[model samples]
Target: MREGAVRWLSPAGFFTMRWWEWGPEDGAPVVCVHGLTRSGRDFDALARHLAGAGRRVICPDLPGRGASDWLPDPMLYQPAVYIAALSHLLARLDGPVDWVGTSLGGICGMGIAAMAGHPIRRMVLNDVGAFVPKKAMARIRDYLGTEPVFRDIPALEAHLRAVHAPFGALSDAEWRHLAETSARPAEGGIALHYDPAIAAPIRAAEAQALDMQGLWEKVRIPVLLIRGAESDLLLPETAAAMAAEPHVTLAEVAGAGHAPALMDAAQIALVAEFLAQ
Candidate 1:
């Protein structure tokens, strides 16, 4: 894989969007987008598998997370801003792209794919839908505003496991990789890579309801919806409603809640198969 950055100007100032590129440059493009508070590295396993199968995979670290530059104003961290950044990234690509997005990333993909002349040829929404439960939204908002300090990598890893237990059963190596990539050296020991202020917009918009039915209906390309069986965020009823659409297909990952970390062979195979179709 190769790492690179794309510079662009936002209302706050100029910033660089970092990304990890894999597979042949001339091959078909597949863009993998991470959830809120996560980075591009989350897709390492999936990207490699797709790359090996002859696809150009691009995983981007959204602004305020991972290697991307933090915004000057926290309010600028909303979905519109993210969509704009994605637009900039896609403009540089050769042709249409197959998209894989998780949680917040999936929301952004819906907006883009609904556009009149979007370049998204296919889409995979990991564990999100138009209507997110109020309880789950509240749970996410409660923790997003705080920045915790850890004594070491091990300590940080423990915290991640506790908060993200819903990600299901990840191996020791997968947990370690997640911890290493999600953190950075801090004054005390280590801290999460993302900007805590990015939570401001989420908190502010908590009261507002999300209605993406119109957008979903507008999408002309094929879509795959992968849901964690025990997820509190994407309810089974919602998934059923989404699947009612002729263009959408649904898959569930057992032993997972809220979201599934696509690290296991089975999980990766599901994505690979969908994208291949």
Candidate 2:
């Protein structure tokens, strides 16, 4: 594993934002963003593949997830704050970069890239688009409310399998790998790696009127939008509309839903080709 740097940025006055870098320090940089309720660790396989192709992959544990500290309020977990955090992250990089974002991460990338003078040179959005369907968002709420615990790693691993079966046909070893990285030892025993409060902002969205469709039209950067064939969040109509843009690139992965892990070679190759362009 290559060494990574930890940097803090101040967003919303009192919050200290944090992100980490991985892969070769001197190589071309690509920023990897994780989905909501997930962390930078989600990009491990993709990062390793990209690093092998001679690029520096920077993955951030979005606020309230992974090793990053939580904010005082969960409402701040929205994409706008994430866009600001990423803008700061890009500024620290000192140059334009390619981006690979999954779900919430992709939304943040889209939001920032839509603005003027954005630093993104290329983007790959995994399993998300400007329009997220009500059904998909509803399903998210079902799992997001749970605060489950387990007596041991095996039990936790079993739970992860049940909850994340949508991840497609990952091997037992693969499931074990994710389970190990995504669980933490707690006073009660083992639990998921993220803060429970992280779900608050996500659930609150049900009551708000989000205007994500308006935002997608403004993004001018070259984008590669990959959707899971079985995704409920990014409907086909929304994906088609998103791809209708002049600089958009789109792909659909089979046997996956909500998000594709970018775990396979074909997904990595598509992303690498875009970055190399």
Candidate 3:
């Protein structure tokens, strides 16, 4: 794995966005973006799998999460901010790239793919859609801004298993990996890697409704929608509606709830097949 950073200047100031790379430099580029509160490391297993299949996989830690710099103004933590950062990343790449995005990441991909002449040639949206259920939104809001301390790694892992149980039944090793990557050194113990201030704009945005149907209808490229069978965020009906689009392909992961981790071999294979098309 190779680690690098891109220098980007936002309206607030300058910051460095970090990313993990795999596979050959000349291989077709595939960008994987993580969900809110999760870092790019979440895609470690999936990135390695795709890279091994002869694709250059780039996993970026969205600002405020993982090794990326946090924003001074929490208000800058919106989708527009993310879209701007993604544009910079695409500019750094060789050509149009395949995108795999989860939750907030999926929404950002949608915004980019909807643009004319966007660099995204194909996209895989994991557990997200034009219409997100308010119940799921409230559930995400419940923990987005919290700064909780863990006495030990085990404690942190336990908490993560509880909160993210919807990710489905992951192996003990997988749980530990998630816990390790999700934590950062803090006073007395450790805290989540992401900045809690990111929740500020999210909370404010919740006061209004998000209507992305117009944007969704504008995307011209092929899209693969990977939905958790029991997802509260991207409901079954929403997934069905999205599949009605000519360019959309839908896959529902059984046993998963709000989202599928995409760590298993089967899930990775499914994603690889879609991108190959």
Best by lDDT: 1
Candidate 1 stretches with Cα past 4 Å from truth are 205-208
lDDT, model 2: 0.79
TM-score of each: 0.97, 0.92, 0.97
- Lowest lDDT sum, 10 consecutive residues, model 2, at 3-12
Task: Evaluate all candidate structures by whole-model CA lDDT and list the values in order.
Answer: 0.91, 0.79, 0.90
Instruction: Show model 2 residue runs off by greater than 4 Å.
Output: 3-20, 205-211
lDDT per residue (tens digit) for residues 125-184 in model 2: 888888776667777776785878888888988987787776777778777877887887
- Cα RMSD of all models vs. native, in order, equals 1.1, 2.0, 1.1
Q: What is candidate 2's CA lDDT for residue 63?
A: 72
C-alpha positional error of residue 77 in candidate 2 after TM-score superposition, expressed in Å: 2.0
User: Of the candidates numbered 1 and 2, which has the greater lDDT value?
Assistant: 1
Model 2 TM: 0.92
